[model samples]
Target: MNDRDRAPIDDTRFGAITVRQDGQDRIEVHGEAVPRVTLERDPAAEADPQIAIGTRDRSHLTMRVDGAEVDLLPAKGRLARHSYRVDVEYDGASYRLVPDSVPSSRLTRDGTHLGDFSSDGDETVIAEWREDRELRPADAAIGYALASAFGTGAQPMWMMIADGVSSALP
Candidate 1:
């Protein structure tokens, strides 16, 4: 549906956080600030807005916003983990801001490797499912939370998480 009908993101001095429905089962997260970020949303687009992340030559990650694409890249650093950020717009609002640093870790379960990644470093967050499995309790909870926060039906949560992490550069 429209963003106005969804829950409003909490606004802070540094930035604001918002969630809006994309398609029937998709929701988008937007973060924005004055100089560091901007937020926007438009409904007449064909695809959701997106953000791409990686080195100039290698694009390993991406996030789709109101049908557009924004590139996310890591800041220069010697550490194994790097900070990735991007801009996104949807439903008539534009979010042009860098995301906060998210700490990523390698995960493994039952001989299956889930890969190395992290949420936005915020304990209260939701993500989409990527690996092959039915929705886990935690992930399902996240979906429900997101849906409740944005006022939408339950949808995939890991998609947002994967997009947020894969787009980060090493």
Candidate 2:
């Protein structure tokens, strides 16, 4: 679906950002510094995380949007926190995606509730807003960044950390 038909973003979450984009490489936020967007990945990611034993390492997709960066980390295990989590910090706002088996995943900005993205059918994912909020064009920019970064299904470096943490447990 288009942005117009999508759920609205709550004012308390990102009402301050009055900018938007056309799914392009740039996003301008009102009263916030614009970030330089880039798509990059570490070539020396041989020591990245892995679920299956293999000498070859997996490279994750990284997107640098303005001041914040978004990394899509592959799932280390079946029950990994998120198959791929986006660690992002845009302008002065921070965004996170917490994936769950039910109701899909939750998106938060600066510790505030933004909305929940769930599969609507076989081809679409819908975002359910917490409050009666209006989604800004800037919000779509963030989503585009995430989609670009995670579209390749690369494994993020954080997955190794999570795996290490899990291994340390008795």
Candidate 3:
């Protein structure tokens, strides 16, 4: 099904072409069926929570979208909130989702530009991406994989300390 046939974003738990919060710790990407993909915190992850993307057999820090296993790697930075600075590739295109200060994030592909993700000071995540129908699903997966940086109770002790230290220097 195409975008036209898909359910409205607010009507679906997730969107056929977008991602949405299922609860505090779980998110779902709706499409094809009720939830084509789901992302949640990996209980076994060390330090900061590693995201598990996909349905029942989800993998940590990886999102299976558009037939590609996009690994959300921690883009090298001085912070331990590993998910906040994420790098991934999908449909053979490289993308990075980095923080643009608090309550906002930037998503760039091949270092060109796409859009940004910002919080409404609540549990909701809002994204403004270029009007490209083809990339919407990929963008949703990539952005939601790290969107928790703006979610409540997501910052672990290590992340707080790392961010604090990094902010103090330079």
Task: Name the candidate that leads on TM-score.
Answer: 3
**Clash list (residue pairs), candidate 3:** 16-30
- Would you estimate the TM-scores of all the predictions? 0.24, 0.42, 0.53
Worst 10 residues of 1 by lDDT: 49-58
**So what's the TM-score on candidate 3?**
0.53
Which digits, one per residue and each the tens of the lDDT, describe model 3 over residues 79-133?
4433456667666788777766555677787876677776542235566666553
lDDT of 1 by residue, 63-164 (tens): 343334444232332222312222223333332222222433322222233233334322233333345643222222222222222221111235556766
Clashes of 2: 6
C-alpha local distance difference test of each model: 0.31, 0.43, 0.51
Identify the runs in model 1 with alpha carbons over 4 angstroms from their true place.
Answer: 14-17, 21-71, 74-79, 83-170
Worst 10 residues of 2 by lDDT: 48-57
Collision count for each candidate, in order: 47, 6, 1
1 or 2: which has the higher TM-score?
A: 2
Question: What would the per-residue lDDT of candidate 2 be over residues 37-92, giving only the tens digit for each residue?
Answer: 54444444442223111111124344555545554343433344465555566566
Q: Evaluate model 2: give its lDDT.
A: 0.43
Better of 1 and 3 by TM-score: 3
